[model samples]
Target: MSAPSPAQADTPRSTGFLLLFALANAGGVIGYLPLLSILLPARIDAIAGDARLDLFTITVIAGAAAASLSNIAFGWLSDRSGGRRRWVAFGLALTAAAYAAVALATTPVAIVLAIVAFQIAINALLAPFLAIMADEIPDSQKGVAGGLLAFAAPVASAFSAMLVLSPFTDTTRLLLIPAAAALCVLPMLRTKPRLLAIQTVEKTLSPPRELAIAWGSRLLIQISGAVLSLYSFYYFQSLGTRPDLAARVAQVLTIAYVLALPIAVLSGRVSDRIGRRKPFLLAAAFTAALGLTGMAATRDFGMAALCFGLFQIGSAVFLALHSAFATQLLPNPQHRGRDLGLLNLTNTLPSLLGPLLAWTLATPQDFGAVMLVLAALAICGGLVILFIRED
Candidate 1:
């Protein structure tokens, strides 16, 4: 490799600090659309009456599928656009339109359609926003950026805390998020950078077998994590903690995520310093599994809250490092978005099945088996880091 010019040296990877800030704010809004996780499920619960569980499950599947597929497709399209700005604009516009339509949705079908629209919009925005970070961010700062990205969950959760923005009366939250995301992308649209031409030096990334293993681990971890993310509010409700309790649980989970960021950043830096990835991943995963497992066994809300914090610790570590690790192991940089899309699909698509799994393992009184399964998946994902090649 030749010495880079000052201009070239100045480019921050997608995982860099500024883009990370943009993503933290933008994704914070989009991810925490108050209605989706809490109010929307409650809405389904009311509509389904006796069949609330089954009907809510359907909504989960539909939303997840829409979000997942759109994520990949939009990412691919952004690659073709040769820039992230256009796709972000398209996504924000779609989300804003969908949010506006949600107020008018009176029936289950209408609600589902509106939510699907929002899901599509979110996926579109997420794909390019994340891809840009991956493309521009250098590995040195990746962990900190990843830590910021991990903070997005808490940020979204906190943003959605305004009870005034409940599903019944407030679609204003939706309006704000999409609008913010659009505005955030506006600056990038005007002065997009030109990619420097270089010789395409072929590098063999992870072999097919290793790639398969990595994907398998990703799928399992996401499926496990999705159960909690998709249905935590419902689960808390199942435990006899009504609406207020459910909200508190959500808040606690959000706090857990917030607490994990610094820990994840520190772990990531240690990983880089030691020139190893698997060790930190392994340690974090086990900690998460223990926390998740505790959630299954604990009946006290406080204990459950502690367990949530453990989950945060593990998830933060993985989030900070996973993209960096996966990107390095991929077969080619040219197809980074597509490959990352595949990895992301594990996160988004599994929610389609997450609810069903939750339903099967936990009803009104039981949650042990389901939580255990999720914890197991977290552990498994960490182990996959061991199988990947570093050099």
Candidate 2:
């Protein structure tokens, strides 16, 4: 979107608009994440069998490479065009088509191509949406907005997994539901963008050192959390359970997320009401570290889920606050799309790294090493947050 004029920047949005935006975001999350987190790996294993890891590795590598390029390119395009709504609509349409192709593909090559396409489409949707937040949401409500965005993930995860994994074993429904559900948010995509009032703050970026620390802190914690979730099914199997038990892992994580939602949303509301972000962010980081430590120390499924739930609660808090905080730190209000795209790398690039880290540190025989590594990274993420000056 074009740089908001000073008047546009000061305009206020209604609560209804923000709620719709959050729901729109949830549509995207529901569309992609279940496929990414659960089904794709299973599908890859089905196709590649013994070579699933090798092929899955290749798929992730290719998809991440595509995502990194497409995210920035699309953000630049949206900025140049001075519009985001059309791009978002187009992305949803394209992703629906891609999901259909994925469902129909019998060959590994075709499936990988479909996945790459889906990644590009999803990122196209995401980058512009985030830019919209920077353009429209006032600073006073950013934490609330961020909490809404954060709230979508778990709600979507639980709903989508139960719908796809439990009720139907057919591939068509698995793919088609995401395609259809994505359109649920299309109503929110009105022709015009609503602008938000700005709070008193510099429009320019924070100091380079502060920005770097803030960015790095999120990067480290996200890598750890993403890896933990991405391979959770495998992590379940490693505990010596039956193979069928893998499907139940999503349900377990769903429970964790369900438990985490209140804590995340309430923490965010409290932060916004009190005009503080750093303390909550730091608390989340340290709490995540403690939870990860417990996850590493236990092998029992019940105990592991409890620990993982604790981690999820902390992660939910951190992610919401971090996004709100990061937007405030953007270097150029004129380039919010481009800048947020770069910052979003901290989200996508971790998907690429998490697998490699898992491969190196966690073997089938021993998953604790990866958990410990994540714990340490989370601690580091917390420490770095100490360096950023919010005021």
lDDT of 2: 0.78
Where does model 2 exceed 4 Å of error? 1-12, 166-169, 196-205
* CA RMSD, predictions in order: 3.9, 2.5
Query: Which digits, one per residue and each the tens of the lDDT, describe model 2 over residues 55-131?
Result: 77778767877888888888888888876877887777777777778788677898779889888988888778778
Off by over 4 Å in 1: 1-29, 163-168, 180-209
Local distance difference test scores for all models: 0.67, 0.78
Candidate 1 lDDT, 223-299, residue by residue in tens:
76777776777666656655476468658766886788678767766766676777776787788788889989988
Spell out the clash pairs found in candidate 2.
2-82, 205-331
> Whole-model lDDT, candidate 1?
0.67
Residue 303, candidate 1: alpha-carbon lDDT: 81
